[model samples]
Target: MGRHSPAPAPSAAASAAAAAAASSASTPPPRGGRAPRDADADSPSAAELRGLLEDGDGGAAPGGGRELSYLQAVNFAGGLLLPLRLPSAHAIHKRPSAAYLEAGTLLGEEAGRLLKLAGPLFIEGITNIGAQLVATTTVSRLGAGPLALSALVLAQTQLNFGYSIVCGIAAAMETCAGQAFGARHYALLGLILQCAMALCLLFAVPTAALWASGAMAPLLVRLGQLPDVAAAAGSLLQLMWPVLPLLVVSETTGQYLLAQGVAAPASVAGLTSLACAVPAYWWLVGRLGWLRGAPAAQVSLQAIAAVVVVAWRSARDARVARTEPHRATWRGWSFEALRGLPTYARYAVPAAAMLCAEWWIWEAVVFLAGLLPSRAEVQLGALGFVMQVSIATWTLSYSIGTGAATRIANALGAGHASNARRIFVLACCLLAVANSAVAATLWCLRHRLSAALTPDPEIGAEVRRILPAAILGVVGDGQVAVLGGLLRAAGRQSTGALIHFCTYWLFGLPAGVLLGFVFEWGALGLWMGVASATALQAVALHAWVALGLDWQREVRRSAATVGALLGSTGATPTPAAAPARSFAIAGLEEDGLTEEEEDGDEEGGGGGAGAGAGSALTSPAGAGGGSGLTSPLLGGRG
Candidate 1:
């Protein structure tokens, strides 16, 4: 009744008019005191305006959070599990950690699948010639200098350092290139490609030269290793040194090809080296009897072949590099490109150290295993075979993880935080499902697999007994690979390096040694220790990425550091953007481009306005407006 009586006045419009007039009177007008249009009147204040920009700007997408499609699930499962079955057969025996070999299974499988599904069209379009060499065959077979052989084997030990450096550098390119590319910066990609090539040449060529000079031997000696092995290693290093130019060219060009979604070059270079090197090694050393001392001779010939193959490959690569499009939009080199040198240096140096540390630790294990009683050492060697098998599995994980890296890196570069979060989640789910299958398969094949690898019944039995733990260790380690990749994708190498250091040095190694040597737990202890460290590392890396730490600042910081290093090489730098905020990926494309390219686009985009970074080259998604998911993760350290 009271409301009805009050409503009798019906003064709603008048009341509103009066309130509006009063509110307007309370606030001062513009300088000219003219009435404003609705757009201006509705325009938010500075704080509100900031929020509006933040909300509307497309740094993160809302609709495309990752959800598993049947194809993705199948793809993930096949990638994760098949490598468990075939890794050792591929590249397990030669690598440092085998994590990439294991994780790379996904990449191999994907490559195969793409070729199969899309046929020659896919193969021609997506092949990576450079990667083929690394992934398909052993580089040690490429050359024939006794000194080169030593260098190459020793070089294998240095691969981790090289991969980390490559990944970091490529990522910088991806960031810078992605933006320029998206904004139609063709000229930038071209310039960046040249600058990057020069940078790679500067370091890689010199490194190969020093490696060949037998100078690397003293370094090993400094590390407190035996003189005999070091001497041998040094000899091998010298023989392999001549292939340095090839290696440098392969890596740098591979990155360029992968970044541009033209991975056939990487695969081709890889295939050429592998095809020529492997057969050359066996034919020259094993059949032809080129030199004396089986291992040394074998190494020498391998180096010679590697050099020839690599040299030829490099020449071809040079032609390709020269032919790349030179767009007119290519702008002048910015101060940012030079400025980013320090940022990359800061990130890369620690990463390299961590890589070296991890490699040395494993080398110590292999060496120590050699020193054990003959029977124990023999058993350890058998265990080594098992480790190889496990590593092959890890490559699959690495490939998948790198896929994750590509997605995350691409999303960030594209300023799509939500998409990055989605990619992260999808990767995690795929890893778990894949790892679980790996555990099951390893469990089932323990008896047969062990028997096949060795003739001794006792050794086989022992291997069988520890098989479960080993597989478990692999699963855990594979997960860590993905997480580490995630960190790299986010341009958080320092965090990843720190996690790797703590896990491998403080946790994995010490614990394994204590268990294997002190407690005499043997293979089980070693496997358990590895498992423990992997678990810890996975957790730590995931936490860092999952927490969505300040990525833009990381971008800025990394840029500054990388810029500083390149500046010394005569590269210019660009101005820094406002620091990025914390971000997470929710959903991602199951098939983003190769990990390096994905990151390369973004890295290249933001680092400097390089010609390659912004060129109107084909995107990862191909020519279709498909999210261009073809960028490489730049985290293919495996």
Candidate 2:
């Protein structure tokens, strides 16, 4: 699509004339100009005015309403698009020259909204990593030796691999459910949730089987791990075997709630699970001194979180049914969910690939650390500590990103293109500030953090030595986390997967191998390479968001995606009795019409509520409908 500059600001004289024209149109025209009744008849009705605004067309309305004068149409369109543009001098002066104050107020409001959404998610993420951190710390306190730490790291790596797969699969729900909820397709949200859970369970079975099998030990041994370390890791894997399916349940259900902006249950569940597991870890690992206690505690943690989240969801569903039935998203399980599986997988597979591609690279880095010719145990332990710190930081960024994704997807689903872009920009700013603070704090306490995480002086020293690379990685990770969310919101997971493969596997790993093995820089070199790759990935992803994203196109696609899912299941929205496109556009505020006003207009026009509002904007016959206009601010056709 060709780009168009923003519409020029109207002159004072033009504004006056437009206002006068509008006033004249409302009242009777001059006696010699036209008959009062004829002028009234010639003027567009409320429905036609709505059509003209929504269609972004400057000509006559679709149903042959009288042609609007250029000044009148421009003024009308300007008023509709005004909220999207920066405040103009004249517009601001009309409100007592409070432009700067208003802008600051708006910025504060948007920031507060984002933080409120991200706060619970951040707490949940911290609690998620708490189990691993506590286990690692417990092992260190018991003086379990580098062998134990190495083994724990390897086992956790495998578990993370499986978890990432399930997470990627579940990520599709963030888009589908978020959009469905925003579109007010409450029943569709339930079906999407079920479909995602089913897919995650289907994938979890083999992953759990792999962890349960004896093959992991030999595989690790072949990958250059020492015999004892490989065996120990395999044992831990067996103890943690049940976490995969439990994770499927937890992750899917958590996504379901998050999509609907219900995060308190997950946060509470995470805190409760962590609270219960810490003492279990203390008693089993620190007190009784069982090496196996760590993985066992992890198993308990996952189980508790899964049970709590599921129970909370059920209770929430029941309460909603009792009080607000229309708001409830849970419809009991049915074959409709089964029918949506293929549709879910279309986004799920690529999402899985995107996560796994990046996730496995860290596992590869750990394996490479094991291959060091000297002090392999110390290197492995150090790398494990660093990985834990990195994961903790990543969870924070990921939480913020997930929150942003929910907001962005909701905006797009509701045809609020300007709102989605605004959210993206706000999220980026928030992440940058957050990541910078985290990096500064981490840098300041690197030595202390290293010493506290590991009892061994050698491992601690190595961790301290390589700490800067991990800090750099955290900065890059913050960027990619939110950018990845943007991709997911736009349903571009396939593109994300490709970017991950190219950046990490094709470039990062090879560079790390060369730097560590060939150049003899060891673990630090490997981390440096990975950190550089992360930076590159962030750059590429950011470029895409800035240059390639088309918010209006995303809005259209969201409608189509939700519509297709509904069609596939032979279900229609109950609250939204209008056509699907009308329902999608119902949330848009660009037409300067309140819901009641639009409803009245539609009803008066002999159409269902919202029909007049959406039909003229989304229908092919409307100007700038299926074939979009060449406006830079508004994206092109789908």
Predicted candidate 2 versus true structure: per-residue lDDT over 1-638, tens digit per residue:
11222333443333443465567657755675523321111333445444433433333232221112221232233222212223322332222124334445545655665566677788888887776678877777773698888788778777887888999999998778877665556677788988998999898988788878867999999977789999989988877889998988888998887776666767888899889976888877865454578877788888999999999789877887788676578988888787888878888999999889988898789878989877887887788789879888998898888878876776565555655676777788788888999999999998889879889889889999899899977878988888889888877888889999999988899999888889988898888888888899999888876666656667667666666567666555544323222100111113222333222211101001111112112221112222132222221121
Most TM-score-accurate candidate: 2
**Clash totals in order:** 161, 0
| lDDT of every predicted structure (CA atoms) | 0.46, 0.68
In model 1, the runs with Cα more than 4 Å from the true position are 1-186, 190-206, 215-231, 286-340, 357-360, 371-375, 548-638
**What's model 2's overall lDDT?**
0.68
Superposed by TM-score, candidate 2 places the C-alpha of residue 404 at a distance from the truth, in angstroms, of 0.5
Each candidate: RMSD: 15.6, 11.0
lDDT of 1 by residue, 1-638 (tens): 00111112212332333355457546776895443321101222345223322322232222111111111222233323222111222231222224334545544443332222122212222222222233223333444544434444454565445544544455444434333333233444445555555555666677777766768778888977566557766665565454444444444444443333333443343344445554555554455432222334334433543354345435544554466433232344454444345434444455455445545666656655554544675557567767666766766666556545544444444333333444455566666787789878888888888988788877777778667877877767667766765665555656666777788888987898788777877766666776788788777766765454544333222232222333333432232222222111111111223222322322112111111121122322112112222332122121
Report how far off residue 187 is in candidate 2 (Å). Answer: 0.9
Clashing pairs in 2: none
